[model samples]
Target: MASAALGEELKCSICLYFYADPVTMRCCGHNFCRVCIDHVLNTQDLESRVYSCPGCSIKFQERPALQKNVTLGNMVEKFLSTHRDGAVISCTYCVDSPVPAVRSCLLCEASLCDKHLRVHSKSPEHVLNDPSTSLEKRKCSVHKEFLKYYCTKDAICICMSCRLDGKHRGHRVEILAKASENKKKKLRNVLEKLVTKREKTEVRVRSVEERRRKSQEKASGEAERVTALFIDIRRRLDDLEKRILREISRQEEKLSLSSSDVIQRLEIKKEELSRKMRHIEELCNMADPLTVLQDPDTGDLCDPEVERGDEDIEENGVGDQDLGQISRISHSLADIIRGVALYVQDPADTLLDVNTAGNNLLISDDLKTATWTETCQNHRQTAKRFLNYHQVMSRRGYISGRHYWDVEMSKLGVCRVGMCYPSIDREGDKSVIGDNTKSWCLFGGQGYDNQCSVKHNNNQIRLPHQISSNRVRICLDYEAGQLSFYELCDPIRHLHTFTATFTEPLHAALWVCGGSIKILGRSSYEEP
Candidate 1:
């Protein structure tokens, strides 16, 4: 009986259960469970500007100070030992040896073991709940009534008092299951939108990755071409100079042969005159002049052999005979050198091959010029024709000679004059003159930032400065394996040169799209 009285005194006024972690109000010294009073204070209307104690009916203009009541807490803990977490739920009626309770009777405010539950009435008044040691938690802490609904607007569960008398009285509410289902539907839409956004981000990332790859490729090619430009220029000039020197050597050799033969013949004539003179001296210096005349036949000795020889010598040799032939050689060599220089400075000997021309390329009557044509020509398609690219090759191919050609860029919209093997690709972007290993070129066009570029082996080099001259010159030394370029300015600037062993005969190529390139001239030099 004393235990029952102690239970009533320890119970919270709001939850109608044992005081749990009890706190007290300074205003009225109220002793209610912490959660029970907290919920009451939290749901109070600020607009009403009034606070009332649930247990004492004490009123306060502002919230009263709350402090932990250590003494009260100890008492509650000692009384609610059976309700502590981890304790076995047993029938309250079992005194000595309590059996585990399966059902809690809220109406009776007690837990019943299985054996007691089966005998108890199953009437609606019993109101059996899940076996829990704390029956007070099954109801509202403030109203002491069962929680039945979820406050949708506040997104919180509520009891009968909160639904009817609290701030959530007029708020949207639903059963717990229905509210959870509604929230899940909204969350699914958010998930779908996030998935769509992620997919779009992935696509953009791929696009950027592809661009990065292409950029790297372009940069690599550019670097290679620029390095090749400076290196090849020196090589080309050296090769051309050596070839010119070889030509000079050949001409001098030829001149030496003729001069040598004449000198040899003159020396033979002198030896014949010396033998005759020796014969006369032997006759004249002999104390045996009479013996000489008698022993060798006086008539033969007296015969005018010396006079005849002198006459022959005077008539046959050294008459304006420049045995040295130095003047003649010098003149010949000079002429040959001049001619070789011309071969590397002009292209009068180079002309276009109309058969290898693109259909849009208009060829001159003499096949010396090419211009872009609006209409396709009435010509048969062949492997040689530049069917796709706007370019043309020369009719002449060089194997072992020095050649030169010129192009005037004043009348051109785009220009690429260069040397290329006949086997160069004739169809793709790679076929564009100077863009592959088979070709080298001086490019002046609009597509490349309206600047200049040299292309070879699929690499490109942008020129540091724009071309100021309207004409450019190309020189190739096949024997020495070099190709060089020049700008036909007032002083004729050296542009660039490429050095390589020519594995096959090369043809002059011109890339003139929407413009024209005429073979102004061509010249060639080989061992004469």
Candidate 2:
């Protein structure tokens, strides 16, 4: 009986025989013979492109890969080896020859072939089951009778004699079939729940896998970009170093030439003084006195009244002007280094959020530009839409790290560039950029000549000078809680900086009244 049950477990539903090269299905975890499953899958309706598991009837949109069940195959092989000859039970009645048994009678304690089964008693007590070698298991050891009843209290099978007179006497008992049916009903309920849990788990697993794949892709892209950026930085630095060295050498050469000219003039003056001294010595010797007197004393006798001043010689040597030029170059180098460091931060590629744009604003197809239209546009009504002001916020928000982006505006327009929390008012005057406490902005007035101002919480500070350029750069350091604005001119000038502790993620906010503003830089929607 044990071997028969084990055989049933190892058998394939398609072949109705022991598994050969057993394979397990991923969808239903059912095992089948590899050749049998492949043949069945191949015969499925190709037009429909749907296949099902023969064991569980679970359908699949596409054919699933078959995983070889090595453990099951090994179990089958072991079973076959152990039961090589005993696989088919022989009839006890056919003692003269080995005849395969069709059924075994528990009441007779013997297996019967077709010929013997016909002569066997046909009674309820003579229970016949599939041919099994272990018939002793069907009888109760204590009562020596077939187990026909199940003790509910003890949860065991027993014979009629045990139920009536043995230790199980008077215990609540049921027919073996009824007990098995009740247990199966409970197990089916459990199986349904397990199937539901498995489905939900599969969904979660797929979601996690997708996130992992995206993370790897994003990391790879970032690494490549960073590598290229550093390479370019190194090249620029190397070029700058070489240029500075050349400038230093050129300055040194110019100074050296100036000093050389001064040295040559001094050498000529020294030779003339030596000749005057020689003439003076000859006069002292008396024979040349009359000749010296006759030679006519020129200005050379009085040391030639030093023509150039001490200042002239000093000027020919290294001076403050030369050092000052080199100092300025060094400062410029420092500025370039600082600018490159800032540039290394990820660009805030902000796209205007269409859902947040006011009805009077027209958003560009690329979502980078916003124009103030004279006529109202029919925009979808949403809670985030600005009903009172012609304003819009960026689709992306930042909670940490540094970001910078440029905004190019028409010189004739009045526009406000700023940062605002997502919870800023959407339908009132407070919704206007820089009008509420939740936002801060640099407001450019109607003309290029008009000075700009920084505003927040309805308070404004007018800048001393007009914004000289149409391009503005906005920088944010979320961790430091600093938001700064700069006029992108020949030399970028700082317009204003607001310092405050940020309590929520901030979006780049914009308000345009007369012309348009176009955002510039790569717009990344990734969250930090």
Candidate 3:
């Protein structure tokens, strides 16, 4: 009775069966199968934007999130395993009081208790097996006999009469027990192969999960770095803006003081001029010409040169010097931004490919350094091997996104650092880095010349100044179609940039003549 009650509680209200994947409704806390509830919710009126629980009829404002009922699911699994055959069989003769049976007879089609088993028929036709409620399933419907053998051709169970006189008379047949055992052996073989495949698939799943974790970590770190950089830029810009405004205010105050002094001088000069005019009127009122001539020259009293000088001061009150100071401060804002280093989070891990190395070029065992030697090494000639030029390509290539790597020159003598397509010519002069359209490079010359130039498709642009630093950085933005080189110094300086639509994935290429170059791993921008 307890098991029956537990089974009823574990059953889903919609499906009326044991819960396969039990879930509890957030609104009413009633358990139901996940699929049954999802189907009911999906069929509801979407315009209403509401769902109703099947068990409790509780209306929800929105579709509620389902909470898995793990404990209830486990209870259903255990109940099914313990009572797989349903209710126990009882003796047919025990009408007064039903008692559990020990064995069931196929011919009599009745279950027998221990008290009746001793008197039951022991004939071969009356097959007795473990107590079972399904007695008709163990008999042949047509012959009305117990199934004794399995017909191989028909792949069905048959009785003794059907095997000898029925339609399966000429077919091969085996004892039912032996035939069932053989089939189990074949199924076990298939199960073993399936287990092996599943194990391999699990290993791949773990690898993919690890990759996903690393990508998430990388994205988080990059986001933090970028946020900090932009915050600094905004702070600096705010400071510059305040400084410029303060400079303008200072110039305005100085100009106001100068203009005020000029206005005071003009007011005094006007009073004097008015008094002179009154004096001239009195002199003119004198009858004698001598009286007018005796008066001091009024023209001399109001000096024209002095008045012109005061006018010039008022007209030129605002000078270009004030604006020049503000302009200089405004230009410094660009300098501050340019001082910032390029922040690159994704750095390519590059290694020299031995198969693509030229005969004269000797690659380090670690595959990070490439040196030019006079003696040609006995390397097997392959299609990818560079036969004419002393060059070697990296093992990996990139087709998208930004990547940065650093190269340090032990001896800067005719060394080239650049990138090239994997399909670059291998046996001709074009195979050399920067000689064809498929390649781009920064070429450093040897000796006192120490000249530097960038070459692409046989066209070279010579840089004005020689590069003194031996360390250089290469940056590639594939989507933007930009590849730039920078000289790593006290303050990193940009050497040149090449802009072109990349047609194929690019590999790091190196060419050495009299010196050696080593890869110093990937480059990362450090906050200054």
Candidate 4:
């Protein structure tokens, strides 16, 4: 009942699918598949069995209630039982026999009933096979007999008569062993080769994708920054204009006030001068001429007042000459006003001539393409597999902690796989397999010591043994800002003879110089 109600939600949160070997977190009471939890923990570098819930921050130290839900399991079992049997068919052993039920023998040339089949196996004359169910059991195409043995030279199964014929004569033969086993070996070899090629191609795709993503992001960021800068520039320009405008306004106001004062003083002086000139005219026109011409008995005292008035008139005229300089100042103010008015315009209309367009800010095509090409080429050279290089594309940069040339053969044909970095010793050049050390830097692998190996174009690194058919992955370290090589290995999955070559990081040669980095190898889980 609970299973039905929570059916959809019960799916493991990690894989977002039906649970496979479910396990529960103790603290938070959350459940997840075993593989999913293990993968997360392993990749995250947790040493203890204790883990925190992904959905919640609760920590758990001990295993929790992790019993499988039998209700869900039963439903899957029932569904498979009903549909799977449709593929089975009648046994081939009973096709041509007279008996109601016939059983085939491993060696005997005849079919038998259940009773006879038991008796035949007990008899020393024939060998009996364990019965198994299959779909449309095969009968010999040439002889209409069940196949019992395989001919290695002909690479086919045959009946007793077919074995003696010229087509299979003298061929190495054995009991027709498990057909699935033979098929698996052939398929594994093909799958391995295909995977190697795919890995190479993927390297290119990954590099290009990463570069394009970053390039676009960087360009977008720069555009935003430029926009912000323009806003600041406009503000600064406005402030400068405002300061100059204020200064001009103040100067004009000062000139206006000074001009008014000069004009008022000139008018007052003109009125005073006009009054003096009128008095002089009246003296000339009147009978007072007798008094004007007569000097008193005391000549020293006569017309002393008139002398004083004349002297005052001379002083006022001199003041008028000094006041004339005000007109020159007014002319300077007019010039400034004309210049300020001409410069004041729209702020938006101003065009900044800053040059910012260039290709240096972008991720270059040549760098990305070269990195991808090198990665693909290395996979071909190291894995001893031919790949369609054109199919590959560059992807984002990758860093590998492990030196790859150390793939071990002992772990092949297994389910679990691992990758590790090799180590370097004081005698660095002597530790490598090849004599040249200029082209490569050996960081270190898990087991290698005191050996140097050289890698050149078209050179192949021989594996110690064969590898199983599995998904092959290759990684490179591109932090050096230039193309370099990395050796890749997974000791658990293969004993392959080849070392995978990986491309180094994308770089800006126009800005950054090429430099070498030491390679490091350990388990693929090691820090890159």
Model 2 agreement with the true structure over 133-159: per-residue lDDT tens digits: 778998999878999999999999999
Candidate 3, residues 1-528: lDDT per residue as tens digits?
655687788789999999987999877899889878877875663234478888777888777889989999888876664344555467888899877687889899998999999899998877887677778988888998889899999999999999999999989999999999999999889978986886687567657766766787788887898788677777878888999999999888887887788788778877977887898888878899876777656647567787787677567653433888999788766545533445645545689999999888899999999998999997998889998888999998989877778898765468899999999999887788888999999988565376789999989999988878888888888888989888776345677899999999999999989889999875434434
How big is the positional error of residue 402 in model 1, measured in Å on the Cα after superposition?
1.0
Query: Can you write out model 4's per-residue Cα lDDT over 1-528, one digit (the tens) per residue?
Result: 333344445567788865665666554566777668656654333345465667675665543434445555554443233222323222345566333323445445444556666555576545444333321244467776666678777778787777787377777887766655787889999979986887687567657766876777777885676577446545644655665566666666766666676667667867866876676566567785576566343244346785676566455434322233444444334333221211211111111111110111122233221111122223213221112211111122135332221212111111111221122111233322222221222112222221222232314344433333222222223332222222222212211222444343311111111111111211122231
lDDT against the true structure, each candidate = 0.73, 0.81, 0.82, 0.40
TM-score of decoy 2: 0.64
TM-score of 1: 0.34
Off by over 4 Å in 1: 1-348, 446-450, 525-528
Give lDDT tens digits, candidate 1, residues 14-122. Answer: 9987777789998888888877886687455223547889977788878677888999989766545544443556788888896767678886788888788888888
Winner by TM-score? 2
Residue-level lDDT for 318 in candidate 2: 43
Query: What's the residue-level lDDT of 260 in candidate 2?
Result: 82
Evaluated against the true structure, the overall lDDT of model 2 is 0.81
